[model samples]
Target: MKNYFWNMLINIKNGQMAKKSVIIGPRKNICESFLKILWNEGFISGYKISPQNTRNLEIFLAYTKNGKPVINSLKFLSKPSQRIYYSSKQIWKIDSSKTFIIFSTNLGLKSITECKKNKIGGEPLIVIN
Candidate 1:
């Protein structure tokens, strides 16, 4: 099956600031880490964890002053069938600091910059720009 979290994120980005937030179904550690990274980087305004019969995560989307969604595109770099791993040195060599790169490093789900800072390597998760 396709990744539910990635699908949700892509759909939200395609909607172009149409909704303030979305409620996603219960997710594992990887998905949670991805959301946390997005919030910390300001790609998303905020998120709240709500648990009832099932765990649901509410995420507030970010938008520009022109009333446009902040995210232009969101793509997964790694998948269950095909994976991409990178080293800290390779990450530092990346020229574009503006593009957000999520890395599943030893320290947990971290951005490329964070991976570089910690001097670690990991599987590249996704890129959002």
Candidate 2:
């Protein structure tokens, strides 16, 4: 499924800038629904990351239909300080003018907090279940 998603993103990147933000969280029914929502909204260049693989931190950078940078998702290994560090790095890679909305479960709260503390600019819309 991961490979499939990667391929789909690659294809979507061939066109213009996609107005989308990266989503990271546990792999659940809601997460899939979120992807569908983005797709239907013309936010096709995106990526998903499961909690189990958060430590590795995979980043997916795609362009919008107009050639703007749209980072869909970034996966980072969960650790005491890694989230803040990775968030900074990810934020640096993209255009600061572009806004990013992150979706995650409660498990990501700590990381989200770290991002806020560092002023990474990623507005996290956490979903609690």
Question: Which pairs, if any, clash in model 1?
Answer: none
User: lDDT tens digits, residues 25-111, model 1?
Assistant: 445566677778888888877767765534666667788898777787877889888988888788888764678888888788888
lDDT of each: 0.74, 0.40
Top candidate, metric lDDT: 1
Point to the candidate with the largest TM-score.
1
What is the C-alpha local distance difference test score of candidate 2?
0.40
In candidate 1, position 12 carries an lDDT of 61
Give candidate 2's TM-score.
0.26
Against the true structure, what is each candidate's TM-score?
Answer: 0.81, 0.26
Q: Please give the distance, in angstroms, between residue 54's alpha carbon in candidate 2 and its true position after superposition.
A: 32
Tens digits of per-residue lDDT, candidate 2, 11-111, equal: 33432234334433334444445455444434454455645685322223445567665434433232223332344556455443344334233333222
